[model samples]
Target: MAVDLFTPLTLLLNACLAAVVARRVLGVPVGWPRTILVGLFVTFSIGSAVTSFAEMAGIVTGGRFTVSLSAAFILIGLVTAWVFVLGLVVLVVLEVLAPTGTLPSPLDLLTGWKARRRRARRYAQIMKIAVRHGLGGYLRGRRRTDPYHGTAKIARSLRAALNEGGVTFVKLGQMLSTRRDLIPAEFADQLAALQTRAEPEPWQDIKAAAEKAVGRPLDEVFAEVDPEPLAAASVAQVHAARLLDGAEVVLKVQRPRARTQVTADVEIILRLARRLERGTPWGRSLCVFELAKGFAAALDEELDYTVEQDNLRSVAATIEGIAVPEIHEELSSGTLLVMTRLPGTPVGAAGPLLAGFTAERRERIAHRLLGEVLRQLVRTGIFHADLHPGNVLVGEDGELGLLDFGSVGRLDTPTRSALGMLLLAIDGDDAIAATDALIELLDRPEGLAERELERRIGHLMARYRTGFGRGGPSGMFAELFRLVTAYGFAVPPQIAAAFRALAGLDGTLALISPDIDVVAAAREQGRALMREAVEPGAVRAWLEERLAGYLPIIQRLPRRLNHIVEDLEQGRLSINVRPLAHDGDRHFLNGLVQQIVIAVLAAAATLGAIMLITADVGPMITPDIRLLAVAGGALLLVGFVLALRSLALVFKPR
Candidate 1:
């Protein structure tokens, strides 16, 4: 029996070792306890199944397997054990060879070779594109060595490289275009023109995706489907379709294999970001890893059509003025979204029409838009984060329509309150208050000088005051971002996204009504919002909610106080005061004497209790010396409490 059990036991042990190797050496995610349990079950089941099968096949006379089947099982277990031992040996060798951590582990070398080759191919492609566009010097670090020249050519080459590399690179370039503080102004301007539009997929592919999404043929769902796409992008394409119920809806069909391709590209980008963070000075300041993480999360959210649908519903409920297209939830899937087709002209295309509007009308439109934005920031705390002109539309009836609910911003109550305060401070020209508000919004890094930060903010605000009516809130925000970068504080991605959305809106508003003061408008609107938040009724409700949590404690306070006073009157309460300048040795000796006396008393009490238990010294209760034992136990308990208190005081830090 022992011999029979040995083979399966060895197999289980080998399986456990393999799991460890996969987890530690290869970076596989096999949780330890669960993996061990699974390994044991699998090993036992395999051995038992083989033996039983052999018995059923008449290969064994009774319950044992035939010699051949027995030998095969033993041989398999041996091979597994040998493989595990060999893996351990390889791990040791790799660790020894890569003591400086410059070399990959054996498992990584085997599995990641193809990934490295792919990465090299991509790098070569990027270099080729750069050289073809006369930006090779930039890629080779020559531009950094010299002064920045040929910014236009460099920006064009970068845009081309990103477009060629795939959706991940294009998305990254788009995000960087918004960050004027990080890149040069000219580069940012050029990259902002990088087109996100991709060539549309064929009609047959769209039809197939639609059919698969609705789990039926196209005719059953759509009466008339447009063969040509309405719009095409890196993620998905929109096509016009008429539902069977005569409702005109737009079908958003995800491109075939786009998710898989984007996933791979994002992984590659994340790896590069990690390397950059570890290897370069600029990378450390930029926080490339955190940026990559946020980008990945945003991209993942964008890839799911259902998330966009949910966002649309959420925004519709929160935003009152803006029009969001109603989604047909039953027809929506992970890849396909069906929504009522909105009827309006894009905000960018309405420039000629807007030019014809009266000045009063244009001012009203601008004010309405800005008011909605402020309300989103302060009241609703949910807003369209990507409000570029292309995503916004203006109807003939003067209603503003918001499109593409893929990206939305959310702010918690505290952040919303802080933002209101910041706007108020900026408008009031209280630079110190603005600085304080900004600090409260940020996770202030250690070693940052508060006075210096306030001074710098004051200087920036002074410049704004001198150049009043020049660039408005947008310019202030740009300068603030520069300051945040200069101070080595990692600006939160959400804050950056919010600023970008506001800046875009600011430019739009400028075009609509040049005379409108966005700062003053925001301040007035923010004050109203603040007042509403702290109204009497709201304050009363808030107080009630908070006080409810402490009601029990409040009710017990009187009784607790009475008990404390009684203890004081009975001389049972004592206070110990230790002076700062007291002699350390004398204090330690006094505590030590107290502890020693308490310890001796406890020991004597315990000894007395044992003797009382053995002797008939007190009135017997049920044939036991209960009275003396109880007295001794009580004394011991008192001594223990005193000893613990003395020891605690002796060791407490001064």
Candidate 2:
């Protein structure tokens, strides 16, 4: 074997540089000696791994292997050293270019670099798809030149791209479908049809996944596992199976590498979003980073199979007059879910079944479906956010079955109250109340013209009110979303999703019975809520709750008044009220003082402990000093916690 003289020299220099980079850039808690050792270890490992890979490749190809092994190792080490130096240069350049105080953390930068490389193929595909679909124009600052030119073609292309890109992109398209404010109406409408469809993985792969999840062979877990999947989507595929105990169930197996792929894609999208936010006017107006963050959070929740199982159980418990599948928790994992398979035809395929019903029977079915949706929104405040036709099933007995609880919407008390008011206002044709409620529901942006917004909302409501039977809930929701965007109001994501779901339900119901009135159904639901609110029992409970909250205040008032009266009678009370420059100044000053005290105590204790450790003394004195050092360390920890708590309280939003 021959060795190059420069190899050792270069490796030594690289190791030293790596040590410096680790301490400076990565903040590694190692002294110079330890850092040098780490650097040497890393270099050696990389060299060995690359050399072994090269030797294996050579042997596999029936080429020279043993003769070139040492040479390959040296060559690999040299390349690694060069690459490490280049990376340091790139990092420096990035730091220099990044805006002050906006540079990413070391961990984030490393992760992002890895993600960019990992998803390079996906990124290339995205760009190609975007250009093909005319989305590249937006990146180039070009608005749609012709509003009507090939709109359908562009919409179709974009939908195709989203489908091809994978689950995360499909999910992004689904979210964009609700953002009528950001995307054009035609694009939004087209993207709404972008379903999560993908070819099913092989049965063997699914079986392997199942066995891994259950820690047993497929035969032990199930008496018979179907070879064909019942349904397949980007996230998971469903297969009908019979358990060993004779329980019929469906196994929802997550797609291979779905989580890892989705995560990498999300990181790439987030990086692109950050770039757009910095570079484009459209991105700025839409807040692309915030949108990406929200989408990522939603997708993460959906990726967890356990979340879906919990959602199913919760809806089944609270919702009535609907069939939700029974989950088998014992046989479920984060990647594999087992649930009872309900027998029914998809609502989309139920046209023939619905056609045989009389007009009155169809109306009843429509009413039942609409009523259940309204109940989900009004009474329980948790509802299926994706109520598309494919997710709903109709049994032979005419029972409605709701499936796919992966994407659900939840409303807090305030949001639900606002929604109820808006629904009631719309039902009664009260434009003014509807306008007020809509505005209340929105996070109104600064510098908004309130009166103008109110007038616009009134006009919107009037148009919908006149066309109530003709437009239905779908039209009403569409116009409301349009108005919300027009006024620059940030509608909550959950609220927008709910509106989308309601619009879908409205269309579905209309197919069953054209005469079905969504407004009338909503009005009935509103009346029921009102009736519940004012019931004798409800009113008494409300009164008691209010009284309980006020009892302490009421009891303290008399004593406070007595003290005041006594002070006045004795002429001993002196009032020294002073006007504050700022309402928060007093609290700020108090917090500042507390933080300073804590910081001083912490620093003093830490310093004492450091001094004790560095100082050498006799054995008898050293034991006492060690005890003091321990006490100082404990005091320092306490001080740090108190300081952090105080700072948190001080800076937390009021």
Candidate 3:
């Protein structure tokens, strides 16, 4: 019977349904094999779908169709039932083999069914939320080439799903919002709201977490602790507190369930990212899985307050118009941070805070914010990774304060230098220089088309050189992300974080002063920083700090010089050369040279023989032989053979 008539289609439908039922009953992707049977089910499901489609096509084309839909269904059901009865008999064999874990992969039908068994519930929940929100198509990579490509509906839907997905997803969305290069501006704008507000954890849980983290009574740790959250977010919530002696401070308490909840969510995110990358075009281009892994690590670090404490202290002293909180290390732990409180409003919403501030003062504040962030990114090795408007507080005094050390990007000396160069080149419209600097900032992959990337960067520069709507750093950085993605390049996480921070600073600057041209201000500040850096005192300090690393070598320098001089003066200095260190290489080269010499000699011998034969010198050594002519002939033949052999040797493969 031709299975194309829908015979196999019915079997496949019945078997797949049976598998789904088993999974529903056992709480795993593979419960069908454990309970009833395996292969016949897989075979039936595949067979039914394939046969049904084929038969339908044959009928439409006026070709032979051996089976009716109803008959096919009946046969499929009967055959599957017979297979199930046989499977029951094999259950006894499985029981004996179950103890030894001997179930082979292919025989199991569904591969890696138990791989995610532990997280099956969360996995299912996430899938339901995504599907319910209609995010599957977007997840398959349907966004724009630029920030304008995403539609409002898609963005809104994603934001809603993220909100329902809980803390880790919300945080991820917030991070993506800054990455306009990776997402549409519509999506970025929508996701930014996820960071602005969320219901704070219950007061009871907050109090217990704070007290336990402090390892003392709440009263002992502070004069007063406010239950009202200063700010609520997914990772941690802040509270205003006062020290026992009456010093105002801020208390940052990690949410009680943040770690466990975020951990599970991170795992789910990683899985989703992996699946997207493997199955979708957009994921591969965006390097989605690597991005997830990087974000996961950053989220994990944020859960530990001690890391944030270290980050705060490291950047506490920098630039003139910015202030960073002084960490109270003695009372801090992996989950708690106590620090001096700075009074200010979020720069984005500093309505009343700007009352007394003059227009000039607001402009200065904007420059200060941009300059300070750039200074940290280029000059200092460690800088704030998250500099959103919510994280930067603008005071009445016009000074800005930084908050949230949970995410900071640290650059090694090389990366910092490369990034600094890259920014300066972009500002100057030197695309070639910018391309070179960008390469330095990344781990240069093999077979990269540097020239093509350079051309693309040049085009990007031309497009944005007039005026980047979103300001300089971010728009260009966003474009840069797209360019790298096009070339199949992945920006290292640290460098990417730094780029995002600078881009975010543009938004913060915009908040401080709407009229401020961020690009010009950034350019002015950048050159001014360069000037300040070259001043005598700053240069000397830089030189001194750098030279300190060479102290050991410096100490032995005079002695080394003296020994060199003495050796030269005594004529005892000698230079040793080893052009070819390996014996095999040397031998191979020597053979080549020998072959060349032999070829040349053979040519000379042939010439001499030709001259002898032409000159016809008179000589008689045998009665039947004309000695000169015959000798010439023999020499000529021998030379020809030698020349051919030399050529063969030269052309031979090893």
**Candidate 1 — what's its lDDT?**
0.72
Clashes of 1: 0
Superposed model 2: Cα runs more than 4 Å off: 1-95, 98-116, 140-157, 443-448, 466-472, 561-654
Position 577, candidate 2: lDDT = 68
lDDT score at residue 476, model 3, on the 0-100 scale:
73
Clashing pairs in 3: 4-55, 8-47, 8-48, 9-48, 12-44, 12-45, 147-185, 305-334
Worst 10 residues of 1 by lDDT: 91-100
- Compared with the true structure, model 2 gives a TM-score of 0.70
TM-score list, all predictions: 0.68, 0.70, 0.63
Each prediction's Cα lDDT score? 0.72, 0.74, 0.73
Residue-by-residue lDDT tens digits, candidate 1, 466-571: 4434556656777788797777666666677678778778767777677777766666777777788789998999899989999999999999999999999998
Give Cα distance to truth, residue 176, candidate 1, Å. Answer: 2.5
- TM-score-wise, the better of 1 and 2 is 2
Evaluated at residue 130, the lDDT of candidate 2 is 80
